[model samples]
Target: MLKFFYEEIDFKVPQSLKTSKWLKNISLSEGYKLGDLNYIFCSDDYLLEINKQYLEHDYYTDIITFDNSEEEGKLEGDIYVSIDRVKDNAINIGVSFDIELRRVLVHGLLHLIGFEDSDDDLKQQMRAKEDECLLLY
Candidate 1:
C-alpha cells in the first residue's frame, strides 16, 4: 500500500493515483514487491527538524527515507519530502515543479531499493537510475 500525508503544508500531490501506480510498477520492474510505503510532504523547516532529531544532521535535504521492511526484496518505508526544497530545486535547475517532485519521489524509492549516493560513483549510478525511472514515468 502507498499512502500520502502532509505536515505543515497545504499542498496536494497532483495525479496521485497515476503516481502511485507508476511507483508500484517501478518496484515490480526492480524485482521487488510493494509492501507499505508512506510519503510525507512537509516544509523545509519541518523536515529539517526531523533531520536534526533523527539523523543528527544540520543541513536541509530534499527527502529522507526510512526503510521499515523486515523482509528482503519487499519495499516498506516512510519517505519524507521537503516541498520547499523541491520548489527551490526546480527553479534552480530550470525544471518544472512536477518534474522535480517526481525525481525526489523516485529518489527515495531508489534508496529503499538499495541505491546509495554516498560517493561520486554511486551518485552517478543513482542519477542514471533516476533518469531512467523518470523516463518510465
Candidate 2:
C-alpha cells in the first residue's frame, strides 16, 4: 500500500495508484519492483530544509526522495513533495495541478529506481521519462 504523510502542510490529496502505476511500470521497464512507498507532502520551507540538510542544496525543489529498498527490483523511498513548488511549476509549465503533481511524483519515483537529470543528456532523458510516465495516466 502507498502511504503519504503531511508535514508542514495540510492537503487532502490521497495516495494515488494511477500515480503508483506509473512508478511500477517504470520499475518493471528497468527490472525494478515496487515496494511500500511513503510520500510526505510538505511546504516549501520544510523541503528546503531537507534539501539543505541532505543534499547540500539550499534552494526549493518540487520533490526529494530517499530510497530504502534493499531488494534490487523492489522500489521503496521517502518522497517529500513541495506542493508550493508543484503549483508554481504548474503555472510555469502550463499544466493543470493534477498533471504537474503526477510529473513531480514520477520524478521522485525515477530517483528511487536510479534516474538522474544532472547533465544535459540526462535532463533530456528525464524529461522524456516524465512525459512517458504521463502517458500512463
Best by lDDT: 1
Provide the overall lDDT of each model, using Cα atoms, as 2-decimal numbers: 0.97, 0.85
Query: On residues 85-116, what C-alpha lDDT tens digit does candidate 1 reach at each position?
Result: 99999999999999999999999999999999
Q: State each model's C-alpha RMSD to the native.
A: 0.6, 1.8
Model 1 RMSD in Å is 0.6
Measured by TM-score, the strongest candidate is: 1
Clash pairs of candidate 2?
Answer: 33-73
lDDT of 2 by residue, 1-137 (tens): 46778898978564565666666776788787778888899999999999999999999999988988888778887999999999999999899988898888888888887889889999899989889978877
Candidate 2 local distance difference test against the native: 0.85
For residue 75, what is the lDDT in candidate 1?
Answer: 96
TM-scores of the candidates in the order shown: 0.98, 0.89
